[model samples]
Target: MTDFSGAAFYGLVARLDELIATRPGGADGFSPSARVRTHQNGGYRSAFRGRGMEFDEVRAYQPGDDIRTIDWRVTARTGRTHTKLFQEERERPVLILLDARTFMRFGTRDTFKSVLAAKAAAVLTWVSMEGGDRVGGAVVMPSGIVSHRPQRSRGRILGFVKAMAEATQNGFGAPPPRLEPTLAEAIGRLRQGSRPGTLVFLVSDFHDFDAAAARELNRLSLQCQVTNVFVFDALEAATPRGGHYPVSDGEAISSLNADSAAVRAAYAQRFAARRDAVEALSRQRGMAFIPLQTGDDPAILLHPERMQRTRSGVRGAA
Candidate 1:
């Protein structure tokens, strides 16, 4: 077992630079395997379609030209049949809402959930910026929220990353706000800062996810493309081999008895139920759900092919 000492718990700050350096592969800087799904016509499609359209240029009319786009003025001036061409607009902004509550500062594997969330957000920021999209996000801490309006500047994206690192190091200071209220506040900020077509990523362990919180997220999803990146530890999905384990939350220490088969089964069932509820809520509200375990590399979420293969294996086994 790894030590959960002072330095280990809040060491995410030192890793911020490394996290920001992660670059997903592709000309668009998006992972080839990963695809964000968007809800359109009650069906799912690739989320990053570059859907927005912008007029590119006017050219001589072609056989299949839509009559509606026949630039009458240009045709008259040039004495030729001319058509207006539009290209896919790719300036969509990506807003990443990172949950940095105290609950997220734990991990039994590679690193704390907070660190993983920060790393994921950093990867997203880099990918979005490299893809020519505006990148910004809010870091939701227990004490308050640190938000950066979406912008196309590289400095802005790096600033957001720096803010996350600072928040991780300083801790929330005051008592943490209630989960639902915090989510609501974060969502409100997102609503104010983001446009309708923006992509929003909610990265967190979602420790106190509830009906009201889900409702808030649903409201956000109605306006923008939302993806829930749920960060959790492997221990959350399964209990360790029969043993008495001790846990601490800084202020309080408790022992968990995983010796009994029934206890372990019940623990696993509870976690599964919570996970199911989150997944169901995401599906109900047309949001994409990505689950990241603490032990796994955060980059895996960006890799679509790897995720597809994992899903295929799971379905085959079932």
Candidate 2:
């Protein structure tokens, strides 16, 4: 595995803010194959649910012009019949569903999964802004889920960056009085909250991703474009060099015997099983699946073409 532990492992708000200058390595327009559905005016052809609300410029009234669009004041001023022209808006709502559970805080290579998720989330948030798409996300905390509605503004995106930074650095802060929300619960919340045509990025390590989570995800896919970002560390794919290593459970520490080849093999198989299980739930090629390892440069790696070229290398490693 490629390890960059000495150089980088954790990232804070400043680090996330720095990612605003990030540029992806591909020309992967958001959901290239699917039609664009958004709120604000920008690129691609799009219309509001009921009618086109963005007004262009006024011109002389033409034949078959909508009577409601007639500009009475402009017509009276110019002593001519005039009508309003409405253009379609093109801005998609991008929602990032993040898993900030305790397990995501662990990593053995370059950075923790939580840090990686934050970095990647920052990159995506900036990219969406650049594309003129509104940005927001839902974070799965120990207490429950925190969600931000999509908005076409820089402040909203930064707020999202801030939330992720705190989540990774400070964590969800002491467990709730009741219980933490499961991945399924978080997904269910998103399913109910998200609107049609929104693009969703679900980032997680697939820990405790159960049938309930899959069902919720399937339902969510019907309305929004869902992409599964599978985050993992190098150690998860393989055991380290054979030796007696110290392990911890927060409450106590223990030593692990890694000398046995069978044990190492079993560990690798378990990782593969978990990965395959999540991949299966990703709905094949119909849904986007991104594999983000701990050592990856998320800004460049997230591009569709770059991801396509590197996918084999990522999956082939372990």
Q: Which is the leading candidate under TM-score?
A: 1
lDDT of 1 by residue, 232-313 (tens): 8777777888789987766678988889888888888887777777788888887778887776667776653454434211
List model 2 lDDT by residue over 1-318, tens digit each.
222223343342224444454545442345444355323344544333223655666899889888899989999999999998775654557888877777787776566787787777777776677667777878776556788888777887788877776666443334333456788888888777788767788888878777888788888877777888889987877777789888874557887678988888887888878788777767553567778888778774445456444332137322
TM-score of each: 0.73, 0.72
* Candidate 1, position 40, lDDT: 19
Listed per candidate, the RMSD to the true structure in angstroms reads 8.4, 9.8
Which candidate number would show the highest lDDT if scored against the true structure? Answer: 2
Candidate 1 residue 178 Cα shift, in angstroms, is: 9.1
- Candidate lDDT scores, in order, read 0.69, 0.70
What's the lDDT for candidate 2? 0.70
